[model samples]
Target: MGKFWGKFLRSTAVICLLIIFAVNYRFEMKKTIDRFKKQSDENYYAMEKDVSAVNELLNILETSGNMYYKKNSNIGNHNFDFRYRSKDDIYVSTDDSHRLIAGVNKISSNWAVKKELDMSEILSESYKNISKVMPDIAYMYYASKEGFVNIYPEISKDSYPFLRNIYRLDFVKKELFGKGNKKEEGVSWSDVYKDPLGDELLITAGAPIYDSNTLKGMITLSLKSNFFIKKIDNNLITDFFIVDQKGNVISQMSHGNEEVTSFYDRLPKKLYDKRYKFSDMKPCDIEKIGKYYVYYEQCNSAPWRVYYVTDMVKLNAELLRGNVVFISIWLISLVFLYGASRRKAVVEDSQQTIEKLQVMLRKSDREVEKDFLTGAYNRKGFTKIASSELDRMRRYDLDACVIMMDIDHFKKFNDTYGHACGDFVLKSFVRTVVKNVRLSDIVGRWGGEEFLVLLPETDYKGALLAAEKIRKMVEREVFYYHKQSLKITVTLGVATLNVRKTLEKSVEEADEAMYSGKETGRNRVVGYQDIMSKDIKWKK
Candidate 1:
């Protein structure tokens, strides 16, 4: 009877110990999960904040560029004297040539000879008023039916002889134009030259002048690209570049190497042919190059792309460090709990609990870095992965590319079909994009309606093919909603990252190329280097 009682007592004690161990293990697991959830929430909020701030900066720069161009256009229309340069040698109408008598005895009644009247003087006088109002005016020129006339005092005859020929009102030929234009108009930006001044690159703002119900000539406002670049206050540490549709670097603001001109010119020919349909900003990391966040916005009614990029490593490292420290504290708390727990069964349970907690913590970390919707690395996740990939590529001298894609008219679809349908489209897009890419490729949801695909061991040619395949797949895939079939298309930009290039620059170049695609049309891929090779001409 005493033996039976001892056995019962021992069994009861063991059961109690097991129960206690289970309870403690459960509690610790719950605590760890809670801590992870809280940390993840905090990290997500911080990432959102960072994205908003950077987006705001980009918005400001975009707005400033628009405003500057608008204001300049308005000023040009209101202040400048519009005149047509004649192709034929004809005397200016005496009535039209009459001078205002402010201090003179009488108004000049003689017909102004093309050569007799000081063309430079008339232009200088007309531009003097403009200079007073717009101090940023480096130079202005008026092309009439007769010849080229320099309106600004700063311009010299020796520096711009071509201005005379360009002002001689002639019909635009199709052969000299880019792929898009069949016929060019009189008042267009197409006739503008970059290397005209012989010293620095210049962008011309041209407007055709009308007289007597006829196209007389055109007026051009030549300003250095530097003037526009100066307006953007360099806030982020990333380099800024303004690229034309052809991928030519119009202007760049950077602290790095300067001898990289014609960089985009080196892109494969196949990529250049289809570069005018892509448009989106994408974030990515390059191993030794660092982290990059990029966005592209097109100028209204222009073929230009304003590409903005920032170094993400420097920007987010501080914030990520703070989160890491917070995580460390939670880990230390878990260790303390483990040490305090006692009992062999309890210890075993606690070990299992710790293992589960560790797994949860690791998963939480992944979630924080990954995009919830697509399961691809989020912007943060891309940054981490890209850095590593870039390092691997560089160390082994491998080729790789980053492709960015955005759905065309995505907002309109969302507005018309509802958010649920929009989500379906996004998910469908991710599936299609992933399927079209190689297993070695990494695809991520870059942000709202945008995605980035990292192609390792691929050159520009390979990247372009992949981009084209994905573009076609997305275009062909149909999304169903309430028995209605809907099709969606996307624009893609591809840029290769090589040993000499930084990841930020590569992404920016790709973004610029993508926007060029958007400007031309949708459902196409654009290679950064390819577009830069040819001079892209825009029709009025």
Candidate 2:
């Protein structure tokens, strides 16, 4: 007997250990699924915000380009190109208009001032348009091939003299005369460069200006690097940055040093050695980099990528906490199970009783709520269910409609056939309607031959469509009683809920319309508005 008991104890301990392992595995799986869900949501919202910002900036650029185009069309024939003259006649050698305007340069200094004023007015308009959208624009200026810069609004007398040769700036040489700018007709962004005036890092957006087919000049909008950083820095809990195609850091949400130029340089040696380029990174791709997990997304409007980096230390800690708790629970359960093995029969009996009581309670609740024959909600249950649904719709400011329907001449059919046949028809009709409506919609027996359907988030137009579909479906359904084919049709009325009325009032409106449909045509759907209009038309 002692040997038999020892074998039994070994078997029970093994089974309990397996149960603990299964529980721990299931818990960990659930946690992993939840973590991924949260990560996906975070990535989606982050991408959406940055994409919207880029799109808005693109729109501002397009608007600025159109302004320049209009100015060119209005003033191209004026021949005022010689406003800025050089001893070398550099512009004149390239542009024929420069020669034409230079021939007439002896006119007057007043005419030259007028031409400058006209150009300044055009620049001012462009500045106003862009500044209104992006108030933090660093500078709005036009750079001409003649090495002239027209800074808008008001350029200080000290800076105006120095800015005249801005065409020599690296931004113009790299962005305007660069390889990508030659073929692309759209706006182009320059890599971050130090502002000569303030020594702050800034980026430029350049839109090319053309004279018929000749490249003339460009309208440039400059913005400080902090424009991108400030918008996102304070909101982020983890490290986030924007990087160029070459893995050069364009802007970071919160970097201690503005001097950190490349994203790859900041990475741990192990990660940098992997040679992961920014251009190759896909949207929402997460990669393990040393002790960190990095997520990146490609911008739709810019040739840049956004990255979010999370430290794996915190994640490991959370996993450790979960495992520790799971082990502690397993240890406690092991001891409890060993002690309870002697009274397993009594415990099993109690568990069975609890389950039986739960089953009875569920059946009792179901019986109270459900219709005996149709499997739909009864009047009391439907009122409770539909009112809750209506409350949710109102809370969310969503559109919803209630459809009231009745079988045409249902009482007459019941009298002709037996009660059992009538019951069969009701069940079949409800079943067909249930299958036709959306899963979100609710069907309930509103007593006798009438039924009510609550369609959440459906507008008046959608509800009308739904009611028409049900009307046609009911007309087509062929019910069979005994060996003979039976026919039945339903009239429906739809009323959409609005701020002006309550849910009950909407249902009353549908009920009235349903009666109206029966009075006019036995197999049709009528909206509450239709009945109201017909009544008014009859009175007239």
10 residues in a row with least lDDT, candidate 1 = 98-107
Q: Write the per-residue lDDT of candidate 1 for residues 93-197, one digit (tens) a residue.
A: 112221210101121233432221233233334556655554544555544443334344443324333443433322222212221322233223332234443
Highest-scoring model, TM-score? 2
| Tens-digit per-residue lDDT, 1-540, candidate 2 | 997898798678869798878887677644533453245335435544544464565556545544555554442233334433344332211232211112112223354333433443354455666677676677776665544455544443244334534555666886456644344456667666666545566667776655334454566777777666554422112567777655667677557435538887766576678655544554546666666666665453455667766655555554444455455556666657556653222123445544643443342222135664587876656778877876776687777789999998887667888776888889989999998999988898886789999888888889999999998998998988776688889999999876557878998999999998999977999999888888899999
Q: For every model shown, what is its TM-score relative to the native structure?
A: 0.35, 0.45
Best model per lDDT: 2
lDDT of 1 at 281: 35
What Cα-based lDDT does every candidate model obtain?
Answer: 0.53, 0.64
